[model samples]
Target: MDTDLGYWIIPLAIIGGAIRVSTPFLFVSLGEALTERSGRINLGLEGTLVFGAMSGYAVAYLTGSPWLGVLAAALCGALFGLVHGVICSLPRVNDIAIGIAMMILGMGLAFYFGKPFVQPVAPDLPAISFGWWSDIPQVRAALEVNVLFLIGAGLAVLLWWMLRATRVGLTLRVVGDSTDAARAMGLRPALIRTCATAVGGAFAGVGGAYLSLYYPGSWNEGISSGQGLMAVALVIFARWNPLACFGAALLFGGAGALGPVLQSVGVSEGYYLFFAAPYVLTLGVLIATSSPKRAMTGAPGELSITK
Candidate 1:
């Protein structure tokens, strides 16, 4: 590799790709963080993510308003979350099993309804031009930050504060810590978990909207690329911290961008290996952060994974 210009291209490409790709992971992981904080593990977010992509794209195509499509996607995602919450609240219901079923259902529905929209062009979300300072076209393109990314970033900060400094946050922590304590304090754990799960799903929906309405700029069966499932793992790596989820998301995004970055730098040999960067990073994080004998310290007491 050329030691001068080539090195800069790879970092720039990775930076740009990280910003673009991290949006979905940020949103999905944030949602999962909240859901897990409420003592529930919702694996169906993959389904919600895909369904949101379909709904967002279809609505944008029909209404000529990308923002409206985003709203529709969030609503659809919340509905999916509600379904999971309700089913899981039942006696002897397994949340993991229900989540898996919901994931399949979401995928099936999206594929069935999204066929017509496979080739249609939906209006894309507008982007902010941070690249104007740079004269280079690639640099300019790399710096074109999406408005949704800003929103997601702001949301991460807001969520972190809300979890630490609010009464609702305390209640959620209590419920997650112990169902008996919540009941004694007159807080309804099930209701709280349901609401948290639904809100989380809504956040994931917005992430899905970013995927189709901004980056990649389309909706299709292959649009998701396992990001939803990856987001679940991201939450674990983040140790259920909302702020940490945001950071973890960026890391995953950087990993995802590795292949393109390497290719951009003219490193053609074994470039395909870089495509697995995100998964490999995820595994590495799990191994490094997890302990065999002791549970992750920050995990919620009532969470299923802990049990």
Candidate 2:
């Protein structure tokens, strides 16, 4: 390949990778955004993600409709979130610990039910094509992106508007910023958190559904590879903004696909190093964004983690 061609190929690959890999991160990051905005962190989203994938694929296989599978995954994810919310509400039970426990439980349940779904060919999601205008094959290939990517972008904008300019968003922010203040205003913190967690879970489930129903339509032990966990980090990196989450997800998507792209081009010797790019970027962002002094001085007063 020409040197200039190689440079162009990288950008094209990045675009393709971003479109393909960001769906899961977008869903999970958005979900985590909602959960964190409620002053609770659902670290168990990893398990919720995998379980949702398994449940989505299994249900789609059984019902012959991918939409129903998406619904089933959302319901299952909501149930898990409910469990996490209820358990964490108990005195002396830390939300993080409960989240970890829920993660284990979700994974175990998924494995149990997913064993029978390892090989079934489920219905795949249809993509929307707008590539006819592109005369170049490479350009057309990039333009023919997944529909979920567009949906995710739309959701991010919608959520940002809702959070910044709506009553419900204000309530959630108040509750997240100060439980006592929310209670003073006669808003039940527990209720708000419960609702937020459930909504977040639903988003995560949809993300999972996208994984099994569209990207790679089959169940297996390795369907998801830490996309859920990275999404949690993504939320923080995005500064709890839904719109920012979209950009962050695309960045993560590019990082994730770098390994495979390099491998395809006969550069497989340091494959593991390429795979570490996303996590390293996440950590770097976290370090850059977090400051103990600033956190102590500026964090929401009722937020337990900062305290």
Candidate 3:
């Protein structure tokens, strides 16, 4: 509550919180980016995210191995993506509508099956300590980066590189830009999109694992909130770029942590409203930047989000 305490702790808390909060966003947005890059959009990732969280927690609880839980979550996510991709591959199917439906189905299944594990505790993912040099407790806490964020960061760099220089990247771009071109190249658009969605879903599942196995570190019906859904706007805001998605996710994480930072500094005035910061940021970005053409600035030409 001290004025001096406010200056230091607020920034540190916000930084740490941003790192913690953004992991989910990082993973989801990256996943969404991959899907979009393939000329397909899987809105169902929200469901995949939540379900991954639940399944990951359940597996870790049963097996006592967080890594196994993460793997399970990834597989679950891929399966969800696969289902969505297959359905959308059918002639005249709507991706957006299917995504919404998948979201509902995933959430419903999680809620129904997650009841038993709600009260049980699961082992959390590990963190890497970069705060050993910092004697200050707050500094130490702020510097304790989680393993997943680091992995996600590494994945972002790898994805960016692959997209720029790899043959697979060229294929994704070609399919996304024009199915006709993809067919001209003898690539199956439907197959590419389905695989991309599955991979994207796998990323979303990892994000879910982070939510349940770390940070919030628990299983509950509302654990994910709307992080999965937010990734869509995030993907657009980042212009479908993987590296940009990392920065955007951090920005969102900082926004989300703002309310808590204020409360920690003893600002009791309208504290609850601060919790809405992330959602507000999402809406503002979408409203200010999104257009009728593929939802934003750098969308894939074949993307049918607007149509």
Comparing 1 and 2 on TM-score, the stronger one: 1
Task: Rank the candidate models, highest lDDT first.
Answer: 3, 1, 2
lDDT of 3 by residue, 42-153 (tens): 9998999999999999999999999999999999999999999999999999999999999999999988988999999999999999989966877877888999999999
Worst 10 residues of 2 by lDDT: 295-304
Instruction: Report the Cα lDDT for residue 173, model 3.
Output: 90
How far does residue 63 in candidate 1 sit from its true spot (Å)?
0.7
Better of 1 and 3 by TM-score: 1
Scored by lDDT, model 3 comes in at: 0.90
Q: How close is every model to the real structure, measured as TM-score?
A: 0.96, 0.92, 0.93
TM-score of 3: 0.93
- What's the lDDT for residue 153 in model 1? 89
- Please identify model 1 stretches exceeding 4 Å from their true place: 1-4
**Model 2: what TM-score?**
0.92
Estimate, for each residue in 1-307, the C-alpha lDDT of model 1 and write its tens digit: 2235558777787788888899999999999999999999999999899999999999999999999999999999999999888887888999999999999999999999999999999999999999888678778878899998999889999988988999988898888889999999999899999999999889888888888898899998999988999899889889988889889888888778888778766787887788887778878878887788897888999999896
